[model samples]
Target: MNLEAIRAIYKFEMNRTFRTPLQSIIAPVISTSLYFVVFGAAIGSRITEIEGVSYGAFIVPGLIMMMILTQSVSNGSFGIYFPKFTGTIYELLSAPVSYFEVVLGYVGAAATKSMILGILVLLTAGFFVPLRIEHPVFMALFLVLTALTFSLVGFIIGILAKGMEQLQTVPLLVIMPLTFLGGTFYSINVLPEIWQTISLANPVLYLVSGFRWSFYGISDVDVSVSLVMIGIFLAACIGVVGWIFRTGYRLKS
Candidate 1:
């Protein structure tokens, strides 16, 4: 609500992120490089082209989504968690800043980190395989929306979390499993009819499918459906997080 306060918190979080370049920057780059080597090169070689694209190239969108999802989640979660751990959160709660400002600050920085890593991984993928951008605008839109959605989810986890362990729980326990099962490396079309139907239940599958569509002008799933799912997820995250802040779910005793 307060634009100045939101901007101030946003700038503060961005500066804090820069101070620790390793967590915000280096780690994602390293992890993405390893993924490009192992999954994109090693395993990709064993499999031939899928949907008329090389296996390495085909997985690029998935890898980018994976990096963006993890970075946004981790950054936003920790951004709130550390402030609470250090007692700065009490100051924030007492400040004139609204809950929207707090989330916008932390979530914006987290999304920026995800975008940076997404671009980096895209570049890295190019080194291994020829890269193409079939729909640049849609690709950018999906990336931003996915980043914002996960950032909000991370903010909720951060607010609800009581300790550092809880901060790691969501991504490790939930996001990871969902991503692997989301048709990241392989399309659901290759699976049995039942498994294919099950894969459709996964939200991450829609994200991966939509992103792949941007790259190759083709996808196993409908792009509009993916966009709609992401929209719903984003709305749900924002609504729940807003409720948590208003009710002081975990922030106030």
Candidate 2:
């Protein structure tokens, strides 16, 4: 409802990205390129194809998902955390802005950044491997949903963090491990039956599977299930954020 307030916050957060183009934009792009070089060249040579798609092409969705998850969390967490760290959160709190507007500002900026990075990596991937997108609409849908979901996750982490070390804890320790194990570079079907079942427990699997399905029409999990899983996760994040705002958890402290 408070469009002007949301826009101001959104612009402020987005402006930070422009200010640190090297860190905000270039670094993630370069890092993803390295993954393509290493995995696509060294590992891809030995493993030829997975599910009839070239090894290099197979990992594109997973790699992009990995980057989007990490960046979404990193950007979202840092965006709000900096305001908390600098003691400016109180000023924002005092403003006439609604909680929804504040969230839209910070999470919107983070998702926008992650989406841009996702598109850039997708384009960059073209140079490494021949690519085909069977369902462009589905691919874009997955991309936007993944970015928004993780951005919200990052927003929660930002509000809950007590310090810089705590800020980096979940993404490094939890998210990264889940992503690597989430059928990123290889299909889970190749795993032992037991491990394949265990892989299902990891939420990132659904994300990668669904996104990869958008590309090749193949997946480790059903695309419908993946959509449901993402919806649940997104809802959970929104619930947590709502609770945080209502309770004034860390924000009021």
Candidate 3:
């Protein structure tokens, strides 16, 4: 394996983030803070508690999950897309690097950034409301898996995208909505019977549910189920990425 190649790519991506701390780090923290302000003030006043946790605290895991998911995708997609957009990807392809090495660099950096943001957001949330982690081990597992899985999804997106519009569209149009609808602001159990059934079909629900369960020991589904759902999705994303590299789907063109 080309450890140097992976290290080079990883350092480049991480350096980019450090160079633009305002956009990469501060912006996300601020955006998440706004969610707490708007949701905590507007909704928390009325709802009070959900499953014995204060509304403000209850939403912490969801908010962190949302941030992790969106940022992972955005970072991974842009890390690769910029290379393609600038026509530098061919240079990368010509380099002494394997496809898996290339992926490790971009996806690893993205996941690292997302985890930082997730932890920072969690800390910031602690300032607003009481917090606890009944299952710290599982919480860490969910965080790492969610970041890596979504980062892979973003890698695939970056390769497939033809332009900036397409690169930005999927996260805005698809991922954001799914996160919101996936037990973020409210639990799916509160929904009507049919809506609950429909909500179960959303993959993001499992991510949020499992993370929330780790925090408060409550979730819409079993923790094992959440683990299974995430594992399946992670495997599927890995398979898709492997296929993309094997065929050179959009990268070769």
Q: Which candidate leads the pack in TM-score?
A: 2
Candidate 2 per-residue C-alpha lDDT over 128-197 given as tens digits, one digit per residue, 9 for 90 to 100: 9988999899999999999999999999999999999999999999999999999998899999999999
Give the TM-score comparing model 3 with the true structure, all chains together.
Answer: 0.98
Q: Give a tens-digit lDDT track for model 3, residues 1-253.
A: 9999999999999999999999999999999988987788677978868979889888899999999999999999999999999988887999999899999999999999999999999998888888999999999999999999999999889988999999999999999999999999998988999999999999999999999999999999999999999999999999999999899888885
Winner of 1 and 2 under lDDT: 2
lDDT of 2 at 133: 96
Model 3: residues >4 Å from true position, as ranges? none
The lDDT per prediction is 0.88, 0.94, 0.94
**Which rank order by TM-score, best down to worst?**
2, 3, 1
- Candidate 3 residue pairs in backbone clash: none
* Off by more than 4 A, model 1: none
Per-residue lDDT tens digits of candidate 1, residues 85-134? 99888889999987878888889988987888889889878888877999
**Could you estimate the TM-score for every candidate?**
0.96, 0.98, 0.98
Q: What number of backbone clashes does candidate 2 have, counting pairs of residues 3 or more apart or in separate chains? A: 0
By TM-score, the better pick of 1 and 2 is: 2
Error of 3 at 12 (Å): 0.3
RMSD of 1: 1.3
